[model samples]
Target chain A: MITREEINNIALLSKLFVAENEMESFRTDMEQMMQFAQCVADADTANINTDDTASSSPMRQDKIGTSLTVQEALANTDASCDGYFVVKKNG
Target chain B: MGRIEQIHSLLCKKDISCRELTEEYLNAIQRDNPELFAYVTVTAQEALTAADKIDRQIAQGGDIGMLSGVPMSIKDNISTRGIRTTCCSKMLADYTPVYDASVWSKLKNSGAVLLGKANMDEFAMGSTGENSCFGASSNPYNTALVSGGSSGGSAVSVSANLAVYSLGTDTGGSVRQPASFCGVVGLKPTYGAVSRYGLVAFASSLDQIGPMASTVEDVSLVFDSIAGGDVLDSTCNRDYKPDTYKTLKDDIKGRTVGIIRQFADNNSISPEVKSSMNEAVKTFEDLGAKVIMVDIPEILRSVPVYCVISCAEASSNLARFDGIRYGYRAQGDFMSIHQLICKSRSEGFGKEVKRRIMMGTNVLSSDKCSFYYDKARALRQALSNEFSRAFSQCDVIIAPTAPTPAFVKNRVVADPTVLYMEDMCTVCTNLASLPAVSLPCGYSAQGLPIGMQIIGDKFSESLILNMAYKFQQATDFMRTSDWGVKL
Candidate 1:
């Protein structure tokens, strides 16, 4: 069963700040969602292969068709220094 | 009336001018769409200009394209030249593509009028249109109910008569499920059948641009126009050219269709969806085609495998949304570039998109890759093999497009898993990269519309369309414009 705390944790992981007032409603809704998902989870895949025999790398070729200048790339960024995008340090 | 036939008759007789048709549609959009949110952007000025050109060409007796003068809408995820291609995300709300997607260019060259860009789930990540930052797109049949999505706007616009047809990308049933809910014809062509040059990637390997329309013939007509090889989409092979969809009307006296065994719990599929599938079986049998039960066990595992693979691909595809490009950029007094990337994405993307991206990132992580992503890929290949074997037994498969009718706006369960389950019936088609179409088959006990999915072998759309057309002709389901009730 989905719980208020579980909803809060999922919200945090998703980077959304759900209001405390909405937690109970979210929990209730998530419970129904879990039930529906359980339906999909019930499909039997026992005999099917579940290992990687296929290529895991990108299929994109190395040939260069288009290029964006560093200046252009960094233009829309909120923080930039010396043609590189800058970001805050996460703990 | 048959949609394509009607358009062709109008053009042949010169009874209704192309410009007049374009103007009428634009007027309809203006009249009905304020509350519908069907179209995120209606290019009235642009469409009229295109229509005038087509009219001039017809007058000159030039070899006009098949879809000449037909007005259509495109999902926001597909880029249109010089227009805002936001994919209903705040991140790219202000961004306009400098170049057009190949499919859009093909339609433009064919003299089709661009009605506008329809709304969708943010970055094509959600099952319901509610995930859009702009707003939820309401079902034209019932404003209180959802239109179904991530191609919600495209489906609703076609259902509401806002356009002749619309284009939607299906990655794990984004297009078909919405089309089913909206009670329109939605096709997810065989993988590589259509170029993905301009479609914003949700899951690149699985994404395909296809047609959604009021009828099966119209869907085929649009599909014929935009399909075929494009140099821009490397995955698409120009070598294979399937027969024209019009040819599907020929006799299929000896053809066989398959019915997938009930794999999930009875509760997984609502009574409405099951009844619709059963009715569809009867209709097929009546059409002189043999119906057989085929069990290719791989489908049972397709859902979780699809979830893992789709999320992994999504995480990689969405990494481009870091605020360094032309999209929404959040501002703060003291922030580093890294802070900006996380902050902009966190703030710009809607809740559903972030959840998928996080799930994707976690699945693709080095430590978890083997357990989730690798296993998913293996299962995908197995599913492909299963489909091939199933095809040996029967020419096609029949299933419900979705498990239930359209839910009311904000009525969806908030759990991500629940939202993911919406694609269960539709995802297997994508998993095998097979051609599938969803057509209205029956209605819920409350009278909400239901859709049946017809799946065919790779590049076998003609057969699928034929089956859908036969059913559409045999039933009253496709005749009416009115559905009248909301969930």
Candidate 2:
């Protein structure tokens, strides 16, 4: 069973708010998916070593490539300050 | 010939102008899309513009490429320069990408006409297309039923002849499931075989942009057109590509076909799907390929492993959508920037998207259960090894694309666990990062399409497509939808 506090904590970490009424159902769904996930632990992974087996992606060329300009990047937003993205700092 | 070739020949011969073909498709979409909802944004002017360009080139007697003048739709999750790419979520509902995804750019360069952006489940998170903020795409076979998703619209467009073919991104069964549901051929290429440069990220490791169409040949044509080395996507392998379309019709007589005996015999598989698999086995045997059972005891665990890992990656990938940048931004009072970001996401995303985000964050959180993600990753390796071992015995493995046929609307809602089970048969390929294709093997009693997938080892697209081609040749299963358009 998942406690409400755990749900609230993760939601905080996720930077999203769970409404007071929606918390129970959210916790329930998380609990059920988590329960389903427990099956992975039942598999005996003794033969596998997880620490040393990181998969590496190939590197692209280090040369500069064409990318979105400051204007193009800032075109879709509601807040901007002379080509830079903007946000409120404090109350 | 594939749809791409058929359209190419018509243009090459001047038998039909590109504008006429483009008009027919646009008209068909206008007539049918009200019921099917396959396309959310149709690029009519762009398609006509491309078509007119092709006509002028033809008038000048200039040679055209294979995909030139072919009308096609792209999943909205793929970024299109100056076109809205919603991923069917309110968060990016009005978001227009400033750059084209690599796949779309490749198609554009090849002169493929853009029909529109296809609808899909929000952020490619849901199993059913019903999760779309716009609306679910209805199955062309029966409008009351769902077009399986998050690539539902891609499948529906091809099935209903809204477009000759469409691009859909598959992370976990998003392409194949919808293809299976809509009675079209869909291929989820090897993970790195196709570039993921402009696809809106769902789960980076599992996400791959693939093609869907009414025939295996068309699927191959679209796959070949879009697949190659991309400097933008490092994960895309430069040397892994083989000319799959050239070898698409190659002989598979002596090749081995593998089947999971347990799944074939399991009660979870509906009677119709089982019958179809049985017939598929006989067909392959008749073609002189040996059929055998391959064992991988971890087959059932693929879904859960996929869930844990995909959600975790999605959480990280989607963190870029903070109210700061180019997606939906919230308005109103807030104390801090952090609060503003939270409010934007909470308001912008739908229920299913929020659920997935929260679920992903929980798995990655500092809680004791964060270990679940690690174990899922380890088990993922184990599963891949098991599949590799299975591959050593057989050239290709066959499995039902879904346990049953497409779900009637609301039938799969309410229980998230039940919805996840719909992906059980399809998630294994994503977990292992292998290539798989879902083609129609048969239909349910109600005439709903049933799909069976042919999975190959990493980068074995040619072998699987050849086998699928051979199977399609010998059988009269729902090879292509016969809804008014033929290539």
- Most DockQ-accurate candidate: 2
Off by over 4 Å in 2: A51-53, B479-487
Residue pairs clashing in model 2 are none
All candidates' TM-scores?
A: 0.87, 0.97
Worst 10 residues of 1 chain B by lDDT: B478-487
Per-residue lDDT over B166-254 for candidate 2, one digit per residue giving the tens place of the 0 to 100 score: 99989999999999999989999998899999999999989999999888898988898888788789889888766788988888889
DockQ of each: 0.24, 0.72
How many steric clashes does model 1 contain? Answer: 8
Best by lDDT: 2
- Please give the distance, in angstroms, between residue B7's alpha carbon in candidate 2 and its true position after superposition: 1.5
Lowest summed lDDT across 10 adjacent residues in model 2 chain B is found at: B478-487
Reproduced native contacts, each prediction:
0.28, 0.77
